[model samples]
Target: MARLIATAEDFAFGPAGKLVTVAEELAARGHALTFAGSGTALQLAERADCWDEVVACPTDAPEFEELVGSRMAAADLLVSCVDRPSVELARKHGLPVAWLDPLTWWWGDEAPVWLPDLELCVVQRSIGAGDAAGPYQELPANHVVVGPIVRTGPERRGDAGSGPLLVNFGGGEAADWYQPGRDTNYPYVIIDLLLTQIDLTGFSQVVVASGERIAAEARRRWPDAPVSFECLGHRDFVERLSSAQAFLTVPGLEAPLEGWAAGVPTLFLPPSNSSQYVQLDEFRRRGVGDLSVHLRDFLPPLDLLSAPLRDRSERFIEQLRDFERTPTIRTEVAARLSDLLTHPEGWMPAVRRGHAYLDELGRDGLERCVAAICALVEREGESA
Candidate 1:
């Protein structure tokens, strides 16, 4: 009944993946949705069956404002995830906007100069244990606080025993703020350790996923590991994790949350960015992420949380010394993986505990936000 324009930040798959979940829900509710995204985010949205139109949201494209403004003309509401430019477009076109931010734990408390006034509803997600002890705090006003915005995960199979153990090295498609090389140095080292140090015979099969460049590197680096590296869009990736008996990956909010939502026994590797560092620590602090590892656990010199927010992973990529070469790091990682892989039934209790913990934090943020977006249009149109 309502026309919706949506977009997500191309920083990582996190925002785009979450947008897909919300968009799919809105589409199921019979709303027409148009999504604008660039790079892999656009590719990801294209894979979803929810969008009526999936246009490229390149800020530098020709007549960008005019093109986007034309699209905005037919929309009743703008839905976005952590993307400022789309919000600016909505404001300029006098459209109602609902801004979804899933990173309340990692973002600064102050709203930007161009933000706030543009938002009809700021769906600020606050998910953590009791404390907001991180460097960032929640914004003070016009907020709808709730939990993580994750789907029910893959359609969950009856035969999970046969599912392969999944290892996600996280993704590499970010804005140009990150330097070249795909941020593969740290995760590549982790994969190298898995190939050389950790034994994978416990699971029937292990599928590794990462960026194209990293997948290429994985093949080049370990040609004989009996493992093929691949990259998956959000839908395929979640479907894989949802059915997995055991999942091992980085502690980024979305992936691990999906694993937890699917009740898969998960082991988190080190953090790729600063926010990931805080998220892993928070999960551990909450006692739900004890099994998860951290960068500090392996590389002591890399104190990512202490550094500035915007400066991420470049030095880690540059000075990435012989990480798997470290005997202690190898030993620690091997032990952690082995512990997760062994007597796998024992791991589910922790996984279930994590599920309960997340539920207690709140899971209805996406539903509530979608309802708000629909209300902004459906009710107003009815009154008219």
Candidate 2:
């Protein structure tokens, strides 16, 4: 059995989705999966028999190289989400690594140099396939295009929201600048906008999910809103989201996927970060969610999202259902990894060349990639 370590470094608002899905897949295939994550992931994983060993790797801790090195020595592969340090340590110990979520390159430029030595780099889309090379380097090789990996189903028990505008900012694991900054430890902007955006006189309640600190601020901010507002966790939150009529939120990738998955119509309050603002634009282009360009765009005496809103919500729901049925990155990565591991010389160069082209031209470039993968598979088929 292959032994693998999947890292949950991106431990904010269901960051472990990728890790959990991949780890579960690998386990079912007779691989032993060990997990390294913050306390949250460990807490969540405790309910399921997902990981062989759940090591607590806090983000605040000092040099974790020794601890990681020790754990990696027993593994053959490592799959990770936004955890470069752990990936680097795994490679140093001669274990193959697959880095997930290439879209997050916004974190650091130094990622590529640390990334290249891995046996494979799995990306979310054909568009994300490329070198982590320097500011002006041509691409390197051995990247594979795989769709995003998501946990198969919701873990937080219960259905979604019943409120007219069911607003949730998710957990405090990660937050954007518009989200009252990560250090503030609350879902302020999300809560503020949801409560203030629309009239609640006829609406049942305006719900917000926040830590105690943020909840206190929300109560202080809107004393006369004439709506019910409170902070809640897993079960209640999921139930709230599932039943919600309209969702008001700041644009974050995961929650929108969840809202869409649950067939909820959501309005995105403009985000503070310019990159995210543009990304939300791209999401609109890709039919991901509904987004507002400006704050006033979603503001006071808020207009209901009309008929177009229902159509888009249903489209997003359909897409999300298809996405759930679609094969995950692990299945694609596993197939690619297994092939590359068995025939490095022949397959590696083809993957490299394919990735270089895809990175430059995006998925529109994938006609060439598909031909290449087909040709490789054909050649292997003939040989077999």
Candidate 3:
């Protein structure tokens, strides 16, 4: 059995989930798997029950490079999800490295300085193709767009007509990144504002899945609003998404891809950052989801007593005000929500298009990825 070191960015749910899926598949194939990444990655690895060992190594840690370099020296191959440290370490050790980048957001001049030996892109085309230059322009030659890396889970019954409306703003990582030092209640605030405008008479239930902090806040805010506030694991999260009737979430790559796979149309809220804004725009352009609606357009300014939180809120409002300077594109966010809720069937065309795209691209992404890893490992063994 080959010894494989898998690493990924662990701050968010998507990368951790994808890494766990890869680790599980490789472990099941009898390969020895060791995972090195952030605390989120460790948590996901523990949940997946695959890794022989897990090391919590945040990307920005001072010793992260040295730690990953040591691991790379012992591993037969490296599989990574946006873990640049691991890729750099692999390059130093001359080890084969495969990058499974689901977001495909790292391209053009913004691409990582050190390219992986193999790039498994999750999108059909590399982003910013026109701006790519020199050696970076040839980077896509090694890219294999395998679509979104969706993990297999317990078969879920499709309840598109009656399933719960899933509301998620992503995991606690996003909260920590977007509104540090504040109670993670921004998503609940968005939901509260949305409920004021949209009529949810047709939906059977509303479920809000996020971090414990957000869940607790949701429970407190919507004590009697016909909503369930519970944080679910990755498998259960996907199962829920698979059976969901609709999704209301921040514009993230994983949730939308899962929603598309489940045939659930999503209404995207304004992104918390510029990266999310880019991904959201791509989703809208692909007709996979609605364009982002700024939260400020639907809700008034937030009042926070916490100094850090208040400062963040003020900055956010300023950014929103600047973004809304263009009058022609500015509309009431509530209007879009109302339109989505009133005519859920209107999204079916987009859903069909997205599904067709997935089908054409092939849905057996994990298998293909596993096969590629095995092939790389075999080739390495032969070279040895």
Candidate 4:
């Protein structure tokens, strides 16, 4: 029974998705585990409620190293999802570590130095192909490239029934662009536009999941619109998703990947952050969604994305502001929603295409990661 510490970058829910899945599998295998995160990742981590201790390790905390270093000294192994600092700390303590990366195409020069023997790199593809958005570094013998890493993974739904429409306005914060006050800023940009143009009364039992601020706004706007607004934990969100007739959300990698894994029909709302914009582009390039609507059409200069991370992120924010301010874009979003609501089953054909894309890449990432981590842990223990 090795002691394990797992963590994910707090930028979005996607990294936490990978963290919790790996931690859950390791815990079920009789290993003691701790989960560390902040922001959306922390929120999702607490929802799992399976950890021996869940420490809130904010990256900017003055005692961040001390907080993480203490855990490293105690743990037998470190498992990280797109979090480099934790891996570095574990290596500093001379421990075995496994790194999970879902955005291999985006990190470029920011990735950590590979430890040939003691670390295992599980690099996952963002989409089918054409993800060479930035420079990619090759890995050593300890690395394996795989597809999406999802939880409670069961491919092919058993007849998606007339379940409620799952409308997700996922985590609202990213680096400098998003903060506490920014909750109702976007996706809501489209939602506000949506409510004005289409009456959701046509759809029954609409469940909109997001932070409290967003939920409150939805409730206030459509007091009698027959919608149930909620702030679901990671596990509860998945429970809701499993039965969803169709899904519409920000184009972050995790949620759609979760839907795709379940064979749930999905449509992407516009992205809120740079990573999501890139993800949206890849989803469109692959033609894998409920009639893919590429945001790039509105924001020309796809070359802006190839710029440095900070520059590109700023560019996305500017363009999103323009998108919100534009009358045509508001109408475009509303029209898309109205058309989809008219034909509810229209998302499935594109979802089948999504499944075919996954089938092309293979979805054994979770199993492969678990096997590698287990092997790494056991080998390290034997060596000690």
Q: Which number leads on lDDT?
A: 4
lDDT of 3 by residue, 168-236 (tens): 766645423544225233465456655675677777888877655567776877788777887777667
What would the per-residue lDDT of candidate 2 be over residues 309-366, giving only the tens digit for each residue? 3343344333323322334522332333233223323422332332333234343322
Model 4, span 1-384: residue lDDT tens: 988888888775778877787788888889998887677778778888668998896755667677878878888888888776777667768878888878767865655656456468787766434445422345577777766677635544435445577888776665444653453257566666655785465444678787555677767777875567887887788877877777778888678888887777787777777888877777776778445455666657455546887787777777777777788976877787677765756767877887888776667877887888899889888888
Top candidate (TM-score): 4
Off by over 4 Å in 2: 27-30, 39-49, 59-63, 102-110, 126-141, 151-166, 171-186, 200-207, 210-243, 272-275, 285-384
CA RMSD of all predictions: 3.3, 16.5, 6.5, 2.9
Instruction: Give the RMSD in angstroms, all C-alphas superposed, for model 3.
Output: 6.5
Residue 350 lDDT in candidate 1: 79
**Candidate 1 lDDT by residue in tens digits, 219-308:** 887888877688787778888786776788877757877887777887877666556666777787776787776656766555554545
Which segments of model 1 are wrong by more than 4 Å? 60-63, 122-124, 127-129, 132-141, 153-162, 179-184, 216-225, 301-308, 312-331, 343-345, 379-384
lDDT of 2: 0.47
Better of 2 and 4 by lDDT: 4
Clashes of each: 0, 12, 0, 0
Order the candidates by TM-score, highest first: 4, 1, 3, 2
lDDT of each: 0.70, 0.47, 0.63, 0.73
- Superposed Cα deviation of residue 316, candidate 4 (Å): 0.5
